[model samples]
Target: MNLIHRAGWRRGILALAVASLLTLAAIEVLSDEPEIALLIGEPYKAMRQRSTASIDPAIPGHSWFNAPKSDARLRFADPQFGFVTPLARFFTVGFSRDQRIDGVRMSPQIEPLLLDDTLKVVLDLQEQWRNAGWVPIRAEEFPSFADTPQWRDRLREVKNVEKAYWRAGDKYQLMLVVSRFRDNKRPTEERYLITLGIHRSRGVQ
Candidate 1:
């Protein structure tokens, strides 16, 4: 090849290498950044506005409901949030009576998932939270069910339950529970449930 042609080829290769590096850097930054969409103390009106902007136009099944004590919930059957698995049946955000967000919860769509797949999904979520700076806490202890009647009831229906907890500095807490139960419709088969909850840390020891 001619000298000029060789130089042109070298420049082209350098340009491609630079572009690839930039793209990789961008992906790393996104992956490292926390994926929590709603801020803990953001006012209801502001959070609603921000969340509305995140709604994907092509996805459906979005609704809002009022929770106990005047708290509110925004639910999405197919959420756009990247942190949760696409298999999640519903994603819900809880807003307290004071009009500020308090927590978020999601459960995997159990009917279609095998027990192993459900366990993998739950573990993957924990890794994602850890990557976002949530430190694993209370790995050896089961979460207290006394405060949440729903969770207490869940314990009675399931077997081989496992729980994990994490904290992000002093600001946030995350809890994950995985369990399996016999399917009433199919007596010989088992069904799994994976529940993930993230909330503002209350300093509960």
Candidate 2:
């Protein structure tokens, strides 16, 4: 009887240990944050579903919209988390001909009213990206503002424009454009327009 009781107790403890491990595994899976790199090649429907479900409605200004001029693209703006850059205003995903995600772009808006705070956030994000293995791309790899029509049009009125580019291996690229302009209405006052975009490397697609 003693031998049988000891064997039963050992089995019970083993079962409890297994159960505990399973529980911990489940918690880890549930707590895992969504990653953009993982979503890059997924189908549009699956990406939308996963992204929508992950959004926290409690986050102020969080919203979704169909990206203008493209039915295949979906945009999530001001999400609670899971963005490479903090305080991002928009996370736009573009689909390829086969309906799989081909590209993702995220940008944080620089609030005119809160310029000081927003600039600090932008600097912090840049540091985080660099620490996470992103390196500046060569100047020759990007187009000159004078040669790019779109950029010329965008910065026509700006006093000066500064551009920076970064790459993460050959998988992704990041662009930062900062334009300083005099407020048209208040010519004495100056303002800044900052745009940041991250794109999947064309070779990877």
Reference-based lDDT, each prediction? 0.56, 0.51
lDDT of 2 by residue, 93-124 (tens): 56666666556554455233133443565566
> Can you list the residue pairs that collide in candidate 2?
none
Off by over 4 Å in 2: 1-38, 53-65, 68-83, 88-91, 113-115, 139-157, 181-189, 202-205
**Candidate 1 runs further than 4 Å off:** 1-36, 52-87, 110-112, 142-158, 184-187
Which candidate number maximizes TM-score? 1
